[model samples]
Target: MAGNHQQLLQLTYIRFVILFCQCCAVAFALLYLRVDLNPWATGLALLLLGLLNLITYARLHSSWPVTQPEFFTQLLADAIIYGFILYQSGGGTNPFIFMLLIPLIITVMTLNNRYIWMMAITVTAIYGSLLVYYVPVVTALSEHQHSLTSLFNFHMLGMWLNFILTVIVITYFIVRINRALQRQQQSLIEEREAKVHHQQVLALGTMAAGTAHELGTPLSTMSVILHEMRTDSTLSDEHREDIDTLQQQVQTCADKLQHMARSVAEEKDSEKTSLATELLDEIIEQWNITRPDVTYSVSIQEDLPPDLRNTTALRQAILNLLNNAADACPKNIEISLRWEPTAIWLTIRDYGAGLSVEQTNTLGQPFISTKGKGLGIGLFLTSTTLAHYDGDVKLYAAQGKGTITEVRLSRRSVHG
Candidate 1:
């Protein structure tokens, strides 16, 4: 955090106006009132005060923000300038002497008792010194009270009371209100970010559905072409095996798209069954076909729960994780499925050129990714998909030089 540089700048401008008024007051006493005063001494003092404020502002680099101590120092300067004005006018008898409290009021708004007490002591010392020695601005004849002097004194006292009361009221009530407002602003920012994240996830789901629809015809054509090539008479035995593998992979993709379509149509069946194989098995088979370059092993607990039945969604999310792992570590990957009493835990460990622990932990954050060309949407969507089922994904550094990702799902998701 920059130390309140914005607030400091704002206060600095307000102080300039105060300093300007003090400078003008001295000029008014000498020229208009024709009072006996040391014009050059007081005039030069006020000028130096303004110069110090300007210097302080100039010294504030964008990188080096003004701190609490620096802000306190500015307030101290204000008190000193006010003290100088009082000394030339009439010591504690100056009409505008209440301006010294301006510094104290600012300190109340921005600093704690420790600094406030320090300021109080400093101002008290200056006021005490002004009482001992000061140049009188008003003549001795003018100081002698006239009938009009009593009325003028009453007016000055009223203004002083009003200024002090206003400062106290604002410090007590407005400071607390401002703090509450800041908290509300922070909450609104967080809520806005969450809404944007949710919208991005929804848009990703829509795009996936549209892509599945568009690819259906092209996949069918590819399957037919592969089938015809397999039937050719002169094809070698090795070539025939490759064609069979390619055909099966293409058919698996088609089946996955069909399942995704069914889920989208909201088929209201409480349960679903596939020919002899479970949903989890079908997912693994499809994933294995897609990631043919990497070797992966899966382990299941003794009494595993049934699949959540929306295999395409979960399958696609896990596929994103596996694909990310493959990109990071191509040699080998290990997947472990363990069943807890209330939850199911799935872990994917990769052993290749591993990323840093900090890098892996931030895998699913929007716009942040470990991959060179990745846009970071894959892991974001994966995390969002798992969150729908009351699940979470976490990434960690492996024991050696690799990354490990663990995903946990509430048991109710599978059990339901």
Candidate 2:
């Protein structure tokens, strides 16, 4: 992923350099061909713009990471500089007034919804103010002032029309590209998750099978001992009763082994059970038995939508979250579930030693764990499953308190 991002950056830089050189050549040719204003000022402004572009490009290419904020700032500077040049040259009369659309187009291409709106508003304000302020000045300076009046109107009208049309085109293409990239990313993530889940299921199945095989000898020996005691005529009634109890315990263990084998075999198949409330109850019961030292309080809101109730991935994800909470709080744990119109939220809070910044940063990543025997698959699987449903997991250590893990899944009613 890092390599891909670096390659994308290099390509973007090359494109920016090419576009900058082209714009410069066009500006110089226009100055030479028709308008002979202050060449010195024009040269200076062009040189400064070129230098800014180079500096921005260098910064982007250097070791420093290019975040969304820095990208927007650079784009905003580019637009303002370009717009200033166009205003100085002729304002509404300049054919290159449409160049203002360049930054807006790039903004739509590279930014999220929030930054796109910011760029749009910025462009509208700058262009509107320039047009209101500079139209008369441009008209007065032309050689054919009377003729220039009509020509200026035509040029300004044409520029606005082109700006709107270009913006529409750019927005359409950029949205399509963003959707495509998102789909590709989601597909890759799902494929990786499937592979990991398959491996885990395989490992678990193998272990279960081995366990059952190993217990076969002990089970047979116990059965033989019980039968021999029962057949002995000299055996006391108390001894026979004891043998019967031992035999019953052995049978119970065998039954448990068989159940585990069945579970493992079922997991090997692709079938999944629905996420009924009973599943949650089962999880709680199992945890209570396994971690008797831990106290748990769970509440699932009654308002959850019917569709959400059957979401197996979500159910499993919640179970994992609960497990993590139980681990964190060997003493006290609280989990709450709430259903809103827009989302379903599950919060698991524990009063234990909270995670450090570094540990939190590595959370949900495979093979990153604080436990000695941890493979770190639980959180990774949980995160991946939640993400599939357009859900998110947030981990935070409360101030002067313990850690909290919040899992939020977009409501099917809203998202679908």
Badly placed stretches (over 4 Å) of model 2 are: 1-282, 299-307, 311-314, 413-416
RMSD of 1: 15.5
The CA lDDT at 219 in model 2 is: 96
Put down candidate 1 lDDT per residue, 1-416, tens digits, no spaces. Answer: 24256546655666676676666666665665556788777777777777877887887655786688888888788788779867877777666667777677667766779989999898888878877877665543565443457547644864575476446544544465356547756878978977988988778778888899899999999999999999999999999999999999999999989977887576445245332125456666777787778887777776746445454566678778888888887666888877667777878899867778688667778778788899878889888878877898988878867888898877677643
Tell me, by lDDT, which candidate is best. Answer: 1
TM-score of each: 0.44, 0.43
Clashing pairs in 1: none
> Alpha carbon lDDT of residue 112, candidate 2?
83
Per-residue lDDT tens digits for candidate 2, residues 356-386, read: 9998888987667856678776787687777
